[model samples]
Target chain A: MKKLINKPDDVIREQLEGMQAAHADLLKVNYEPFYITRAGGPVKGKVALVSGGGSGHEPMHGGFVGHGMLHAACPGEVFTSPTPDQMHEAAKAADGGAGVLNIVKNYTGDVMNFEMAAELAMADGIKVQNIVIDDDIAVKDSLYTAGRRGVGSTVLIEKICGAASEKGYDLEKLSALCRTLNQNGRSMGMALTSCITPGNGEPSFEIGDDEMEIGIGIHGEPGIKRDKIKSVDEITEMMTVSIIEDKPYTRKLKEWDFGKNEWVERELTDEPLKKGDKVIAFVNSMGGTPVSELYGVYRKMAQITDKFGLKIVRNLIGPYITSLEMQGCSITLMKVDDEMIKLWDAPVYTPGLKWGK
Target chain B: MLKKDHVLSWINRCYEVLEENRQYLTKLDTAIGDADHGNNMHRGFKKVHIQFETLQDKDIGAILKSVAMTLISSVGGASGPLYGTFFLQMGTKAGSKEELSPKEVAQIWRAGLEGVKMRGKAEPGDKTMVDVLTPVVESLERDVEAGKSLVEAIDQAVEAAEKGVQDTIPLIARKGRASYLGERSKGHQDPGATSSKLILQALRDSLS
Candidate 1:
């Protein structure tokens, strides 16, 4: 609540304005249904990747929009899903005639809005498809609840799928690859502190100085349980082990069925992380946690991987995806084959992530 | 009979009620879900209020449809799509008529529930907005069929909605972010359901 800001109402617009001014070289901003697209956009003949969600998780959908990452990102109010109009406009802006792929998270609101946008985009004669990322292992229900909330793996999917699209994969191919990446990825996160969304101007959930949320979702959704705050190694061990040993997540998800040109139910089961898996180990700070703390997390993560006989071939440590000023970290372990590693290495440029241009 | 003026009054009262209870709604949500229900509802209604001039001249169906569009675009959370679909379905049944008989009013509520069911995939015990809305519609229809006046039917709807709101306090959530809390979500009132009751109360007041 003490953070610098003029007013809660102006939070998102002002942030976007600052982002637009600073990153004008790589991105272009639009309002009245806020969205951002790559400045040199409509990368002709390649599939366009559009992703969006609530705004508190920054350097995510928006910051990733650039040369070789997301083509466009639709931003809603803090912790609120964007309306369909923004998604539809983003699709139109990013469309290069090859078709568009919407990378949507698995939260109920986000899924519904993205699905509506896909239908609208298709009606306008732009071929549209979508992949829902529900890689978080925190939420235990697949048969009942709204399904597991999408979290850390979202960043991985954007990078890999963005590379595939930039490499001239068509909409169909890119979407297929996205599903593959999502299937191979599983994540678990913990929160040492709660994030305060600007609009609410209050911590999402109150926790004591001695407690922590063990399996928190990105939006500050309640996790498995709260307990006395443990050492970093202990926290890291619990999250990493849960992701590695999680059962095959069974759930029904909707996808844009190309053959029928309509949304259809697709059952997806995430394959568990296995021993001897070659993986890209990602230790991401949840905005408020410092990079130095992330290194501490990675140090413990590497130890855990070694004990499990899983090889950490490559690693990403930073705040690539974050909950606004929330002091926590989420670990994503993606079982990577040559194709995925190749795509992960192919990223070019973006405000939040950049390398291998 | 539910007239066009009644519909306009309902919308106006809805805006006022949400604005009045915005902070309370947010505080309720802070305990179990993201604390934005009040903020979202107020923002959605504020848009409808701004465009009320243009919407007033349209038939009830068109007016409700415009409200749906404004809400779907303005409200940012799960409520945006849920409430937007509620009004959209009501608009379809109410059509272009300036007024409605009791049977027509029941039809509008029926279609609205169907839309909520389809959009949220919620059931009676899910501790969602459906808990309040589904019962309100059922009570409204039953009272109308039992030879009640328009005011009597709305009174029944409001009573059922209030009861439904009370019912949500003990149930475990099976949908949305609240479900993430498991048994801990039991004590907190469902913010969405509480707001739904407010909406029904507004409808009843407008009819009187």
Candidate 2:
């Protein structure tokens, strides 16, 4: 492929090195082969958070490495998984007095590699707990295949979980919270333009200029439907309505007591959700979508959230996670309790992600 | 035909095939699935190639195991685990053996299919590699029952696999990421089935 790279084999290495050089204040380059975290890693007494996957989706595990996110991110070759050895080393490096928590996506390779790495680390006296992210709602049958692929909501999960860990939640508690996040969150993405792999040189797939696919997975996998491009409002309604109906978030709100200071059992209803309840809103770009478009989506999301009266305690807007250079975005909303809201506001700093601390 | 070198050559050939098709596979995946299938298989096969080089004097089982480990590590999508588990199960059946009888080969194929079933949790109508593999394995059994030698059975298996791959074009995917497309998946040949056919073809080519 004709791109600005020294060699096809060295693209990930070169890109990571460049990322390190450009963001020196926020990043650190690990030695060759096992490029895990070394900058803004977990403190001596804090629990470590490590996550990674293929290299094409930038600002994910790597960029999110800083104060409030991952302790280290093991970047594999473009769209490939990092070997178990790399994950093992990252776990060791990030492990402070508290154990290390590995945030793995639900892809088979990622799951197996991370599982093997956890086994290897345990054999080496390292305590590694793993939480797999499977928040995408594009797929319905988790019983059949490997389940839904982790998508944009993974960034929000990491941020919230990191906040929990920062608040001195033990490994078990953090792991539990991670599972809760997975259960409570849902995402759906779409694509307009296909992305070009660094070495492949050409677009991964041919998309007509006028058409769009909805219910697409993050990796540019075919979507549920290929049809005429719809307006932003139509797309938003399709995604949000499906997810909301699937999860029945509006009905779940009735089960919670807003001011009585306790969760109360109630019937599921379609009533407008009340304010004062905590929520996290994420407008994530799918690789190539610009910030301007994402903001438009965020504005739409804000309008929708307003109708529900869901308090937007936290709003994350950016390409925190991506699908190479595919053109689209997914919106994720996580209803939070008071404790989660506090953690969401905690400060932390890392390469591409930074807040509170 | 069907010598020990034949299987080794087939594995090595698969590495080559994956290397060559990496971009195309990833490109196809970018359209309807995660954009990493090409890179994942390429990485897995590259690792297998390295392990093959390192374990030159080892048995076929060792070689297959090495390949399996490599694929499991390097490939990051569904194909990685399914293909890796396929080799791993094959290796488990023929552990450290320098060669296999026709029966042994058939058994290995069955075991490999079982492993794939266990890992992917897919069935024939799901429009998965199973759609290709199930028929091939059955064809292998049928050929062996008809008094065919190992080479003959493998030949029939490859033919069945090719047919199965072609058949995926009309069927809707009901498993894996592609299954999410429902009826839209029709018309395009299943990529996993295509690669699966290629792999079986490699084996047949090496056998003959």
Candidate 3:
């Protein structure tokens, strides 16, 4: 309950205002229906990419909004999905006549709101497509559950898809690439401490000092299993093995059918990782976990990947996505082709991610 | 007959009921889902209560539509769109009607239930609000067909809804955040179903 803030109600707005002030050159915030778009407006002829989810996962949908990344981000209340109107307005503001793509996480609220936004945007004569990301390996069954939660892989999809859009990929092509990125990536997370959402003013879950939660989503919900805390290497191995040994995941996903002019369900399966596959190994901190601890995770991660015969072609290590101040880290291993590797290397400038500008 | 005044009263009652149950609902959600359901519902209804000033003179349809818009924009979770769609569909069915017969009430609620089903894609056993809503809609339709009074039909619907909520306690969740826990999602009553029961109870209270 102890943290820096005025009132719980003002947390999202105040943080957004601070973000606007600090990153004025990179992005602009619209408060009424709340969304963040690139500072200079839409990039003409490029398919605009928009993503959003709950607020506590900072530097995610918001921080990734800038050149060669997300064109806009709609932030919701802490651990809550943004309304459809926010996404509708953002699509209208960010559309450059090349259509808009909504990158939605696999959460129920996030998916439903984005679907409504797509419907609204389409009625307004704007072409819209939604690609849902469900890369978390934690959820074991898709048939009986709500499916896997989207986690660390979302950051990678945004970066690669952003680059593809910058290269003049059409809306349909960008959607396809985004789907491919989701299929090729898998992530698993564990938490040492639970996050305290500002609205609740209490930890989302109580974990004993000696215990940890594995298979956690970004929203601070309790994960699939809680176990006693283990060494960095052992924990890293546990998570990495879950990802590497995960079976091919199949699930029904909703997609906008431009020709049919309606939403349709499509069954998609993610191929399992195998030997000699090239990957971009991402070691991401949940929030309170320091980079030093993440490196400790990456060291073990690198050894494990090597031992498993998976080649680490490139890597990203930091807190790009977070759950308030939860102390944990997630590992994302994304299979990359030459095109994907090249796109990952492309120039990107944003408040949360900047390089090769 | 169900009048516009009754609809308004039901909405106002919902605000008070949700306020009283906020902490209780949050505790339920904390067990199987993220602990925000109570706060999310309370915030949405609080905004809807404010719109009463503007909705006072409107017909039942208009009032319900306004409430839907408020909840959709303010609620900010799976419940937001689900509940928003419920009200919106009711509004659509009740369009331009200041009062409705008991049969008409049944039809409107049926429409709302279908809208929720379409929006959330949840079946009756999914351990969602749909579980509570479906039985209530069925009870209302059956009671109205049997020539029951508005109060009698609603009373039966409330009973059906209560039973539906209880039924969720032993079932595994197959939708929303609770589904993420798999078997662990069992044992707790669903937060969505619980809120849905409160909504139906408010309707019955308003009629009385």
Candidate 4:
């Protein structure tokens, strides 16, 4: 309940205003139907990459809007999906002559809103494609729960796809790369404490001081299991092993079919992590978790990967994707090829992520 | 006849009910869903209230459609689209009529229910708003069969909807975010169903 904010309702707007004021040289904020875009905007002829979700997860979609990253980002209310109008206008503003690609997280509301937005953009003669990330191993695919919740892998997709777009990759190329990244990555998260949503002014769920939630998603949803807190190594290995030993996950997802000019269902399966595979080991703090604890996770992650004979060729460690002040971390291992490796290292400049510029 | 004035009264009644019960409905949502149903509903109806000044002289359908567009734009969660789609279907079915017959009310109710079902893909026992709405429609049908007046039929429908809301207290959710909670969703009254009851009660009050 204790946080710095003027009012519950004004949190998102005030934060956007502050972010725009601080990073005005790199980003522009628009209100009424709120959205953020690159300062230089609609980079002509390059595919426009747009991604968005609820607002609590800061420095994501919004902070990543700059050169060599997301062209525009839609920020919704805290933990609520943005409306289609925001997405439609952001896409229209970000779209160059090439096309537009929407990187949507796999939550139900996000999927529905983005689908409607893509349809809207297409009505105005814009070529748009949507790729839904379902990389979280936490939510077992069932007829009950809506597939896997998109988690840490979303950050990896945005960075890699952003570089690809900057390199002149067309809509098809970028969309294919998105699918490739999604199919090759798996993420698992755990929480030490629950986060309080700003609007509700209450914790989404409760956990005792000694308890921890395993396989948690980014939105403060209760995880798969609650158990007594263990050593950092033990908890790290548990999630790491869950990802490594995870089996092939198969699920049906909807993608826009340009030929048919309608949304068509496609059953996509993720390949399980295997020995001798090369990967990018990403360790992310779930908002409240500090960098020191995340490094502890990555240390254990390195040892575990070595034991499994998988090589950690590249790595990213920080709070890129996060829940609202939740105490935990998620690890994503994306099996990458040489092409993806190059793109990951490509020059990029944004408020949240910047390198090789 | 469902006049524009009555429709405005219904909307005002809805806004008042939602404002009063916002915290209670949100507590219900916290047990299963994302805990924002009451806030979203309150915010949506408040936005609808703002447009009343411009919509007061418009036809009943036009007023309802304005509410639909406002809800769709301002509310930001599952309830937003579901309720928005409901009002849009109802408004469109009611057409531009300044006043509607008893039969037109029945047709409009059915269309709104259809829109909710189509958008959410939820059934009667799925523990959703549809649970309350289904019984409301059935009650209207019964009152019509017994040759009751439109006001009487609508009153009966509101009571039926209240019963339906209570019925959700023991059912498991099969759709929306609450569905993810599985059996944990049982015992908590469905937020959407409770909101449905409130909406129907507002309509019945407008009849007086």
Best by DockQ: 3
- Candidate 3 residues B9-88, lDDT tens each? 99999999999999999999988899999999999999998877999999999999999999999898898899999999
DockQ of each: 0.76, 0.36, 0.79, 0.53
Docking class of 3: medium
- lDDT minimum window of 10 residues, candidate 3 chain A: A215-224
**Number of the top-ranking candidate, with lDDT as the measure:** 3
Question: A223, model 2: CA deviation in Å?
Answer: 4.3
Candidate 4 clashing pairs? none
Alpha-carbon error at A183 in model 3, in Å?
Answer: 0.2
Give the residue spans of candidate 1 off by over 4 A. none
Rank candidates, DockQ, best first. Answer: 3, 1, 4, 2
Q: Can you list the residue pairs that collide in candidate 3?
A: none
lDDT accuracy of residue A7 in candidate 4: 96
- Predicted candidate 3 versus true structure: per-residue lDDT over A69-133, tens digit per residue: 99999999999999999999999999999999999999999999999889899999999999999
Global CA lDDT of candidate 2, please?
Answer: 0.74
Worst 10 residues of 4 chain B by lDDT: B174-183
Stretch of 10 with least lDDT, candidate 4 chain A: A138-147
